[model samples]
Target: MKNLIVASALSLALMGGPVHAQTSAPAPAAAGAKASSDPIVVMRNEQRAARNAFNEAARPIRAERAATVQAAVDKAVAEAKASGKDPVVAGRVARRQATEATKPDFDAKMKPIIEARNEAMAAAKARRDAAMAQR
Candidate 1:
């Protein structure tokens, strides 16, 4: 299911690209300067690669944590239903409680990865913007 969702998302992203991008190779940079050699381009690519690596590393941890939280939510909802409370309100309360219960653990696991990714993205964005401004 995760694989299907990820594949669908990737395919949708690809489909959203410029329509003419499929027609031919992109034009080379001027003066024979390779586009890939540009520092800003390199930084952008590195940022994406780092983000992907973080996502890959975080996936299993996230899945396990989500399942644990979901179990708590299910248990809460079941208990509430057994007491004759409104299921919708019960679900909302369960969700909030589950989220709060799981948040500290989730944040502990994800904080470093999130911080590194954010730094990489910020650096890449700054470099890319500077490069664009020179054009």
Candidate 2:
């Protein structure tokens, strides 16, 4: 679950071509980093970067969802108290409504990122498999 969230951003990040097109002069390795010429490792780094971007993009959507849920809960709780109904049940219903309301926006916003992430992951897997077969 955690990994899915981490490795889930796509498109421009992966399309930067560092994974597929290795430069002649590699950049200096960062502190404590082990730089390599390995294609699989390069691809893995690209995937990680894409996922990071995805997570960053998701932060706003998640924030909006939280706000929406809070608003819904507040309204429902008030209504429940006025009608002498169970606040607990009303809260649950409000949460579900909030999720449903935000779901479409989430899906629309995330579809491209998700597709890109999947493509990059698949390409990496294929490259790794081919390398293993050669070995």
Candidate 3:
């Protein structure tokens, strides 16, 4: 009976050996990598990458929006003068008209950009959350 009990215990220990071994051993470090094993550092890196991508995506949209608004303002001023208005008054009117004309279009164009930025921010937050959960 003792022999049988010892054998059963040995078998159980052997069956659980891999599990214990896995938990006991530290994961091998990567070659030449100095990244802190901290979850926060990993999360920050991910967020930084997302921010970089968002900035890259936003740059062209910003440039185009600026050019379009400028062109619209210029057109408004030219049109005002062509109508025989005083240049100062025309310019004021043009500025208002240009602003009004561009407002909706600008909002429309910016909606997607804003949404994209929000998505990036959300993704960054999600990554951070996940990383925090790891701790």
Q: Each prediction's Cα lDDT score?
A: 0.80, 0.78, 0.72
The best candidate in terms of TM-score: 2
* Candidate 3 clashing pairs, residues 3+ apart or interchain: none
Candidate 2 differs from the real structure by a C-alpha RMSD in angstroms, to one decimal, of 17.5
Against the true structure, candidate 1 has what lDDT?
Answer: 0.80
lDDT pick, better of 2 and 3: 2
TM-score of each model, in listed order: 0.60, 0.62, 0.50
Assess candidate 2 and give its lDDT.
0.78
Q: Which one wins by TM-score: 1 or 3?
A: 1
Stretches off by above 4 angstroms in model 2 are 1-34, 123-135
Write one digit per residue (lDDT tens) for candidate 2, span 1-135: 876665654555676667656665555665224365466776677677778877887788778778988999999999999999999999999999888988998788878878887787777778777876787
What's the candidate order when arranged by decreasing TM-score? 2, 1, 3
Clashes of each: 0, 0, 0
Q: Number of the top candidate by lDDT? A: 1
